[model samples]
Target: MSVRLRTALLPLLFLAPTLSPAEAQSGTRPQDVIITYYNALGHKNYAAAYALWDRQGQNSGKSYAAFKNGFAQTYATYVAITGPVRIEGAAGSLYATVPVKVTAQLKNGQQQSFCGNYVVRKNNTGGSAASQVWRIDRATLR
Candidate 1:
């Protein structure tokens, strides 16, 4: 292969193992939703991350402006799925509890860590195509 072609393809090879945040949002698995959320946050795509919440951010318990401002001091974030996701079904909806450990680096050079579970839900009954995918219902982190 030509040097230019090989160089161009090198980056693609490195990215093959991970999907972009947009692509990840289409994933059917609960864990994928959580991963996509964090990925968006890490990329500073607050709108995409906020939309991952149930009811399109209404269930996030914060206004859109507040949600984005909340990360003003955040430089970057990393999340680790700490345990196996627990899934259950109730009233035609599927819920998944995902354990995670998150570390955030602030713009001031401070780091904050949190560990907890996030409840993700998917509607199995009638709804728009967007609603059928898993979404973050709530979170308990400390």
Candidate 2:
């Protein structure tokens, strides 16, 4: 798999529960955005996951078909978002970086861990309400 895809899918193995209204309005909560993305992936909803990323993040400039195929090869059966997602920069900043770790339980019972940071930027699309959204602009794994 491509490194970028691996990086993206590593964190995509997990799912998070519903968010509270406060979190929805925080705009600075990149974790909630990551949780929502992985939650879509957990349900095999590739389209939804793809939609969560910024234009550049989608397929890393490759076709969506390639992106979907990448996740198909992951073999992840379960995942959990572990630790706190650290936010860098002040609130209302144009961009924020979030540190994340995900533990993926493979179908073969082997567990693997991936650590990464998701760089998300505040979406400036449309009017005020839409501009409040944040999208993953990049995913880097280590």
Candidate 1 Cα lDDT to native: 0.80
Tens digits of lDDT, candidate 1, 24-140: 556766788777787778778899999989998998999999999999988667777899999999999999999998877677666789999999998889878776888889999
User: After superposing candidate 1, which stretches have Cα over 4 Å from the reference?
Assistant: 1-22
lDDT of each: 0.80, 0.62
lDDT of 1 at 106: 71
Clashing pairs in 1: none
Query: Evaluated with lDDT, which candidate comes out highest?
Result: 1
Best TM-score goes to which candidate? 1
Could you give candidate 2's per-residue lDDT for residues 23-47 as a string of tens digits? 5335456667777666666677777
Q: Output the lDDT of residue 42, model 1.
A: 71
User: Looking at model 1, how many pairs of residues clash?
Assistant: 0
